[model samples]
Each structure stands twice: as structure tokens, then as C-alpha cells.
Target: MTQKYRSRARNLLHLGSTQANENFNQMVSSKAPKARHYGGSSSLMNRVSATVLQKNEGHSYLAKDLESIPDPIKLQNFNDFVTFDLETTGFGYCDITQIAASVGSSKYQSYVYPRCQISVEATKVTGMSHSIATNKLYLHGKEVQGKCIRTALLDFIDFLKEKDQPILVGHNIASFDVPILSRLLKEFGLHREFVRIVPAYIDTLKVARKVFSKEEVNGCYKQCNLVEVYLNIKYDAHVAVEDVNSLQQLFTVKLKDKCTDEDVYSITCKSCKESYTDVIKNKIVSKVICEKLSKDGIALQHLQLANRRDPNGLRVILREHGVPFKKCEDLARKIQEE
Candidate 1:
């Protein structure tokens, strides 16, 4: 026994610790698991790959995978939906204090120096004020240099023109923001140019009502409340830029798959008007299919012509445009019946 111990002592002194090997083995076991028969399946490779990635890159490796997954609704013109918000001095004959808009990663924000006085209630909510003596603007009690309403509106128009006839989206924009914007544009003689650059508007308040149940939204569709409900986080509300950012996140996660062009209201010289196309009005297909048809300029007249020429022609065209086979058949059938 003494000889055996002396002979093994040198090797034992130089032995390496097994901690790292044990940790890696534990990670692999957690992913692949001995109880499950993953050894014979293709999922084993995926599980091993995930384990390796986690070991090398930490837990943040899943972020890239989440990003690579395609959105459920494939909008050909998704960039056209520009989420925007406005902060004003007060309601009823008030002037805009701030304007902010966002599309995908692009964003625009500007402060406007109002001609009228900033009311007490508005200041309380928006933290905006204007000094009569100095003729300067302030937000959250900090003095901020702002453009006149004319320059701000011109800059907003230029921002919209950067996209292809952007559709303005906002919370309660139809009854509140749009009316106020329309009045200001007309007051500044910029309505025609504004409508030319922004062809339509979408009110997210109306969209939330359609997408979420009264119970689900907790019977309140306020922008701040909806953001908390959908995104599970609270944001700084009443600020124009933060409001638009939260709104864009809400729409992308919850509303994009459910909304259609039919929800859009056309911008006119004076007010907004519903401008549903014949295809949308007739309900010939799904929202995604309708969007594809609109993107390709395939109107009802084109469908009628194709149906007259060959009964299966419309189906072929829709399929070629990446519409699912089932949706193509349904659209063709509906068009033929029409």
C-alpha cells in the first residue's frame, strides 16, 4: 500500500481540475438531456448548436435568432406607415408645441414656437411653456430653441417626402391631432403640400379598439395604458418623441398583422375620409393579399379583365406574387362570382 501511494503521488500533484469540463457537460445535458431520445433526431444538432452558442456568446445569442424570424404580416410597403405624435399648448384653438414621427429606424422630431399662450392644464400635462418677454420655448422647465410654426411644418413636409407618400399614424389623430394639424396647415397655407406628401392617416385608437377586446385593454385605450398592457413596460408618456416610439413598438408587435389598408383614411383639403378600394370593400381576400394587390397596382378592373380572359388566370397571377395557394383560390373564386 505504501509503494502504490508513492508511485501515484507525482501524477496526482500535476492533475488538472475538472470544473470546466463538468460545466460544459452540464450545459449539454440541460439542452440535449439523457432522458429524451434526441440522439437520433435532427433537433439534436440544433440543440447542440444552441448550447455551443450560449457557451461562447452568453445568453444574448438568441437576440439575433429572434431578429431573423420574419414578421407574420409581410407588408410590401411597410415603410409607408409613419407613426407620429403632437404636443400642443392646449386643446381648442391651440398651437402645436412639438411634432415627432418614426418609421422603422428613422425618426423625426421638432419643437415649434407657438404664437398663443401655453395654457396651465396643457403645461401640466406636456411640461411645455413659452416666455412672452423672451419669446422662447421651454419643455420640462428647460429653455429650448424652437422653429416657428411655418418652418416646423415645412420641415415635417420634407421629412414625409423622404418616404413614398407616407401614411400618418397617431393615437386619437383623427379627432384630435389631424384636425389640429389640418387647421395649422391651412392657417399657414401649407395644406395642399401637406396632403400631397401624406396621402392618408391611421388612428391607432380606432385600431386598438378593433384589435383588443375591452377586457384585454382593461377598458382603457389610452396610449400609455395600451403600451403597458401590450409591451409589459411603462414609458414616459405625454412627450411627443417617446409617445411615437412606444406607439411604433405597440403597432409592430400587436397591430401589424391585423390591420389592412381598409383601416386607412384618406387626407383631403379639409378633413379625413374613408377611401377603401373596390377589392377591400368587397372583401375579396386577406389583408396581406389585399396589400400585395395594391402594391402591384392590381385593381378590381384588372381582376375582371383577367377573369374574363381565363378563369384560372387570376389565381396564377396571385400565386406568382407569393400569395398562398389557398388565398389565391379564394380570391379567384370571389372575383369570378363578382
Candidate 2:
């Protein structure tokens, strides 16, 4: 069937089957890993909860809410931007089960004890359980998962500490890795303000969709799985470092010369004094804005992916509604320039 038809089928028959809604969560958690537990629709971020960003009530309600280094933006000064990933008990409400990151030239992968029972389903694929990998590597005990995720996360932050901008890049990172890592970081005292210092980021998934083609969105929504995108490139772990490596490789193997090469170099971020690519910088600004604009509750539950609005369309939306959008837009534009 066409991607469109398949999506239609999924939506009509089982769109909310695995959602974090009361009924679905109750049913799924019964079989899924207990650690992978998720709260449901109520736990999601509003804007990301659904595709609808606005309503035409003749107007609409409001809402809010990466990557590469070129040669010019290389990590010449500061530490590396540390590419990473997390294999959670479940995508929505489930807790983090395994965390993996690429540190420098090597790799760091950990199967964390989800502070609670991991769901049965989560174990089938993730191969994780309550006793999974204890003493196998650096670990955060189920009890310590909350206390030390941020500390264990420091392994990632340290690598990004160079004079250059530490740019964290990964596949599906903006939605998955960053949020989880940020939550853990806050628990560790990094606080909200210091996040800006963590270097820039890039989600190859986002970049590919925005800058390249996204007919691939079909596989899950309408066409092909991520594997289809790089049918030639083999991916193993479905885990972090490997996925990041796969994504980083995609830019090279698939895009070849089309992708940014040495021409664009990393510039040092004023704050970190670390070198990071311009491409990564752009994503950082975009992310910062998303955090600023995101509406509470709903946006978290949905895990929305905010898109860049065209200035002209934005002007029209603001002018017509008499909202203080211009000022906000001005700030975004300023950040964009920096």
C-alpha cells in the first residue's frame, strides 16, 4: 500500500493504541516494561501532542515550541560536541533504560536501571531489565537514576567543553535525547540557564527533512523506515553511538559532495569559547527558541517538532492578530543572526 494509505489505516484503526492516554497506558504497561511506563496524553507537550499548531476560528490559539560542523566551524578550540543517544524503556512515558554516547575517538554505552520495573515489551527489543548490566559499565542504579543521570551525563558535557562550540548531533536527538538529558541535567543542578553553555546541537533527522527530501516521512506516517533512507549503510545497536555514527556517516556516504564540506568552519561560541560548526550553531538557536516558546503540559506530551516559519507568513499572522509577535520575531531573528 502507499504510505498515505498505510498512515490512514493506522490512524483510523490504532492511532492511539500505544499512546500515553489512560486506557492505552494501562493496557500497554501491563505487558510492556514497567520502567517504560508513560503517563499518557496528559503527560504530553501540548503543541507536539498533535499536528495542529493553529485553528482557523477566524484566528487560532497559541503555542510554542542538530548537527554538523563545517570546516570553518570545526571543533578547533573547545572539546568535542559529543554525539549521543538513549534507548528508553518506551518512547513516551517509559523511563530511560539505556544511555549511550560517543566520547572522543571511542564510545561509552550504558544500560541504566530504570528506577522501576521495565515493561515486558521494552525488554523484547531493548533487551533491558531491572538487573540488566549492573556492574557491566558506569551505571546509574534505579534509585540513582534520578540522582546521577545528570552526573553520568557529565561524560557527555565534558567532551563538549572545548573553546569551540560543543555541538551535539544525533538522529532523533531534538525530540528524544536532548529532552531526556536536559531533564536529568536539571536534576543535577545544571539549572535552566546553563543549558546554553552545553554547546550547539544538530539532529541529522531534522536537517535531512528540512534541507533534503522527506518523502521518507511516509514509512512511519505516509513511506520508508530510516533504514530505507540509507539502504546501503548498515546500522547495528539501534543504540546511541552507533546511530550517531550512522547519521554522521549518512552525511558523508549519501550526500557525498552535496553536504557541507570543509568550506564552512566552526566558529567559537562567545560563551563556551568552543569551536562549533555554523550548521550546528543554526540548530542551537532554533532549539533555544523552541524551549522559550514551548507551551507547558501539551507541548511536552506531544513532543512537538517546531518548524521555522517564513518571515512573511509570520508577519501576516502577527499583524492580522495584533499579538506581540513582532517583538518575539525580532528576538528570534536576532538570535538567528548571532
- In model 2, the worst 10-residue window by lDDT is 295-304
Report the number of the highest-TM-score candidate.
1
**TM-score, structure 2 vs. true:** 0.46
Model 1 lowest lDDT segment of ten: 65-74
Error of 2 at 176 (Å): 2.1
Clashing pairs in 1: none
Tens-digit lDDT string for candidate 1 (249-315): 9988988778875566545412211222555666655656655554433445555667787887767
CA lDDT of every candidate: 0.75, 0.43
What candidate 2 gets wrong by more than 4 Å, as runs, is: 1-81, 103-106, 132-150, 191-196, 211-231, 252-338
**Candidate 1 segments exceeding 4 Å error:** 1-79, 269-338
Q: For residues 223-318, what per-residue lDDT tens digits would candidate 2 score against the true structure?
A: 124545565545564544466565555644543344242212111122122122342365532333333222111121121111133545443432
